[model samples]
Target chain A: MSMPENEIREIEAFLFLEARLADESRYDEWEALWTEDALYWVPRRADLDPAKEVSHIYDNRQRIGTRIRQLKSGFRYSQTPASPMRRVLSNIEIAPAGADEYEAGANFMLMELAIQSTRNMNFWGGRTLYRLRRVDGGLRMVVKKILLIDADEPIANLSFLI
Target chain B: MGMQRTIVYDALVHRDRVHGSLYTDPGVFSDEMDRIFHKGWSFVGHTSEVPNIGDFKRRQIGLQPVIITRNPDNEVRLLFNRCTHRGNMICAKESGNTATFVCPYHGWTFGVGGEMRGVPLQNGMGKDFDKSAMGLANVPRMRIYRGFIFASLAAEGPSFDAYLGKARKLLDRACDMSPDGEVDLSAGWLKHRFHANWKMLPENNTDGYHVNVAHASLMRAVNAFSSQAFDEDKGDNSVTRDWGGGHTELDFAARYHQTGRPFQWFGGVPAAKMPDYVARMEQAYGKDLAQQHMIEGPPHAILFPNLFLAELNISFLIPISANEVVQYYTPLLLKGAPEVNARALRQTEGAMGPGSFLLPEDACMAERNQLGLAAQSPEWLDLRRGLEREYMDEKTGLLSSAVSDEITNRSFWKEYLQLMSSFPGAAA
Candidate 1:
């Protein structure tokens, strides 16, 4: 089923909000965007049929929370001179998967300026099969899978959310 | 002016420390390519990566591009990736199985084994043009230790065994863990490019002092495993021994601690399975070595110039630029191990894989160190940890060690200095 114009605008707005929160390092707000059982996955292979290839980051809500806690913790040395990153999301295409669920596809570019190093950029686009459910008068992400173009290529580190 | 800069290289050398310029200098880096990378038996990739006939992979040996392929006869061959006719890259993809490689630039084709098979517009070339003589230039010498392959650009060097010296025992033990005494590279890998001097990494591996400080997060995560096996009453400590010619091993007693906490393998294996693994290891190596492998914590073994065969996996540090290095991690499994055992091995590798809980922390530390080196002050970095215990053993010609030692780093630099110096008796 085709997504309603209102639902499409809502996803684009949601993605924009996510990009701004991450860019400003407001991770707490970003963390609040997910459902209790939501999954955030960055697959290691381009055609990451989850049954076959492993994911780089396969975080459920609890795991994602733990990551946030670590990032906030002063002891994480890699974040000493914390990396600054900005995510650019564009070309949003929203389609209905169920009555309330919608699948969103968008092109993303994450540019990270690690302290004392030149800017490193990661570019990729994929359809996000989000099982959005209405909860407390807001949409919550049930699942997010990021299929990077160079998923199999050697990467330095994904210190921040893409 | 360039000659004056060359003199600056001589001035940087000192007894206790070397200038940071040595790590940052382009001239020094180029010289290293000629002396160390080009001359030494640098690791390419494991033979298992190209197991089937027509399987091939592209690898960079220093700045040169080379392709390693398995011929129809099952012989492993390493050849320049470029087509001889037009200097076009023969194999563009990173890795794949191909019956023949055709260069898209001008239709020059080569066989899986790098033999020149065909060229378009063959009639246009004079009859004297011999295609038989036009095969891809093979790397000067290639040798395999077990299933691991190393290629050298220079034709002459010590035999592979002689170069490995006592290090062969370590590789043997790693391979012997499998019942079949072989290893396969099938579980896939993690490749990352770090913005740091390549030498710093090899130096860091054996530098035990950084574990408590640089990798504190990883240490914290693995603390649960360490606390259980540690015997506080034993008072056994870690040791870093230099196994001459730039190879070294950092050994920690089964219960040694950093930050007053015992060191542990990051992944936890069940107590029940440990004995079975030990028994299998005992069968592979004799009783004494098996006991050593089990009782002693895994050793951090660094084969100088860019190969690190750690207890968990193998990493190749290929220098891409002065400040950029590509790190490739290949998980090694004992050949013919049971499927369940392979799964366990994969789990262990996953704990250190690209998306592992540990690598991000390690990469962060390395990058931070690189940033620190860019500073104007602190011209010399220190490597004086446990300097007093770097005693050379008379019988084996190896250097013994103690806890908190930089002996391995010192040994690495000693060889680095020797390699960088111009060949004696040869005129400039």
Candidate 2:
């Protein structure tokens, strides 16, 4: 069912905040957006079963923390000089799931200047499905599944918050 | 007719050092495609991929496209992915279960076995055209050792047996992790493109020295590499072995056995997580052997030129050019252990992929190395770490050293030099 206008605005604001945090490489802030039982997945294909097939970024809460720690550690050379990235999200579709859970889908086109290795412009576009639940006060993401446009092909180092 | 073999490999590849040209020169890259890959046997794909007849997957040996197909007789056949008529790729799709490959370029159809089954307009062609001789060309040499398929395009060189030699144990160690003594690759491959030389993959994979330095972030974030063997000073446990014939291993079996623990190699995953798996292993190979297998886990080795039996994952690199390569990885899923296989898939994701915690650092380093190689000042890359400390192991009859030693690098170049120099002044 269609969500209320106020609810939609809150979800959009949360997604925008998450996107900005990730774009700026604000590891802790971006990580804080995730729930205790979080699943941040970047699957090779949308239909890929996590139990059967491997995804690019399949992190549980512990792994999410570890990923954040590594990024924040200052030694993750792949992002020592983090790639300057900007993503534009559009055509968002939001729907209420379970009790307080909401599902939001958005198409994003990210332009990353991959300064780590090749100082060339790397284009990354994908459809993301975000599962957000109302926590204590703010909404937290339970799942952030990214379906990259070129997921099935040979991929370069995507060590960013993408 | 005009082939200039100007590159003297003996001068470039030395015991303690190698020229940077090996990583940058286009001429050298072309030669490697022939001398090392095309002429020599290369790991194609696992047999478990094509379990039934008509199953097929697209593969590449060097740059030549080929198709790995299970024929009607239930035998694995490697067919060049060429339409016998117009030279278009017959099987363009990555993989599928197909009875026959029809070239969309025309109506020329070929059976899964690469036989020229039917032609659309045979009446138009000359009567002398022989369909029997017109089947898709097969790689002359093919061998399967413990379900790991290897193929060679050349008719003769080093036999697959000679190529494998003592290294067969590496495959054995990898396969025996499964309760059924077979590993599966059904999880699929993650192809990570690298803007670096192919040699970097083989050399860096088994180097062992770069782990602490290159993967410092991963070390900080994860408890996976809690092994003392990874530490430089405390070295008696994990050993770096040159398995002779180019095979090298950054062995952690000794370190795991010391703990008397199962799954230490697998990030200390408790045996309780996979009770059915443990019980199956115990029943299959008895308690003692199964415990030993559990303790040891899978092999962390690069099987010579390409295949990397990377503990719970299988990885291999396809060299594209002097400055480019694509490394593919898949979880080494155990045949009978669903629990272990599931974990292995997740582990592979966390360990290697482009976006993973560990391999991104490695990929970055490799690219930086490739970039730095453009400089003419640093003509050589040193491979002399732990030279004095390295010794000949009496048990395995191979050169052995500590984990951080450059013995693995030297071992690779030694075998590489032998293969390159075998055919004097032979141009690729």
Candidate 3:
């Protein structure tokens, strides 16, 4: 069965809002979008086991909070000035996963200026599998699993909220 | 005739400071690659990476591609990844189990041990080709101190023992954490690319002084460290140590031991949470020794040019250029401890890699420092921080001082200066 047009539009809007918060480095507002049981994963390989292998990021809810807090701290030089970022998200596919939940996949290409240090423009593109749920009248992210093009290879500092 | 300016490392490296050009000079970087990484020993992959025969992993020995594979005799081998037929990269995959590495360029197949097994057009060559002799070129020296592998490209220089020297104990300290006296590195590495001099990686990894400055974000965000900020007078016993022959450590053992609590070095993990890990350690070693192991945990040390025993993580840097480096980090998992290993994997993600809380700041600072080196007015970067207070450690008889000392930096420069100055093809 196909997802309703209205439901798809709502999901797309939520994803766009998330991208905007993350792009602008709005830590508090961005953090508010995640549910209590959030799983933020960025894997080195799409099929690797986290129990046996190391990943770029494998943060649970507590770790996600800690990550956001670290970014908010004034002394985070990696994000001191924050990388001036904007991203274009496309090819969004939304599907109903379960009761009051939707699994959405979108491709994003982010242009981030590493102004804090290198000042070189970094291009980051990845496919994100975001799991969202209907909360107390708004949508909250339950998962943000990013699969980067070069996740297994050497990658620059992703201290930003990717 | 125009004058040819010869680079002098002796003039640049001083007792209290070194020239800023050391970070920005391409010639200095080339010299270091030849002298340090090629001629001397550097850490390769661990044996656990390739358990059975035919298992292999790709590695680098100073920009030269090499493969770490297990031979038929179950011995560790370091094979140059170039093909025998033509100069083609033999192994393209990062890691896998393979019967033979077949070069797609010329159709030459090599065994797991890097022996040339077959030629596609055997009759085309005038029958003088010796298959037995035409194997992959092995690195001149290969040593396994515990399961950790290290190799040197140059045929002869220093003995691996002399190269490793007193720093061997650091490996022992890391391996002994497992009940089996083994450290498993089966977990794949997360490569972190940063814009900095290769030397900066080693210096910053164990810098006892930078935690409060560079990593103040993590400290403020979370109650991470044990409030043992580097004031010697504050009864905090952690020290910055120079373990002779360039190896250095920010030893938090004293701080962990002072608490008299097991696993203080491991984020104060309660023994009750890991019942099997605790029980196994006590079973293998005596109760006293195992308890002691728990207190000290793994060593947070830099083993000279490469390799970081970063407490619960293993890291090594691959120098790209004068201003670029790619550092690889993996969780230092124990051999038999499943519960502890699981925690270590998550901990490595939160603390070490590109997306982590702590390391990215260090990367940013290193990159900034490299950029700062471009200003030519101030010729020197000062290494004079705890020079007056440096004293000998009673046990190791090596120099050690407050956690916020330049003992480690000075020690690195001393060894570096010696190698660069005395190198065979140094500038005239």
> Alpha-carbon error at B250 in model 2, in Å?
1.1
Give the poorly placed runs of model 2, Cα more than 4 Å off: B1-5, B224-229
Worst ten-residue run, lDDT, model 2 chain B?
A: B223-232
Off by over 4 Å in 3: B1-5, B226-228
Clashing pairs in 2: none
User: Residue B394 of candidate 1: its Cα lDDT?
Assistant: 75
lDDT of 3 by residue, B144-252 (tens): 9899999888888888999888998999999989999999998999999989999999888878788778888887788755264566667877889998888999988
A56-149: candidate 1 lDDT, tens digit per residue = 6777787677667656655555555466777777777777776666677777776666553444544434444455666776777788777777
Report how far residue A122 has shifted in candidate 3, in Å. Answer: 0.7
Interface C-alpha RMSD after superposing true interface residues, each candidate, one decimal = 3.5, 0.9, 0.7
DockQ of predictions, in order shown: 0.36, 0.81, 0.92
Share of native interface contacts present in candidate 2? 0.78
Angstrom error at residue B337, model 2: 1.5
TM-score of 3: 0.97
True contacts kept of each: 0.32, 0.78, 0.95
Error of 3 at B53 (Å): 1.5
Worst 10 residues of 3 chain A by lDDT: A66-75
Clashes of each: 1, 0, 0
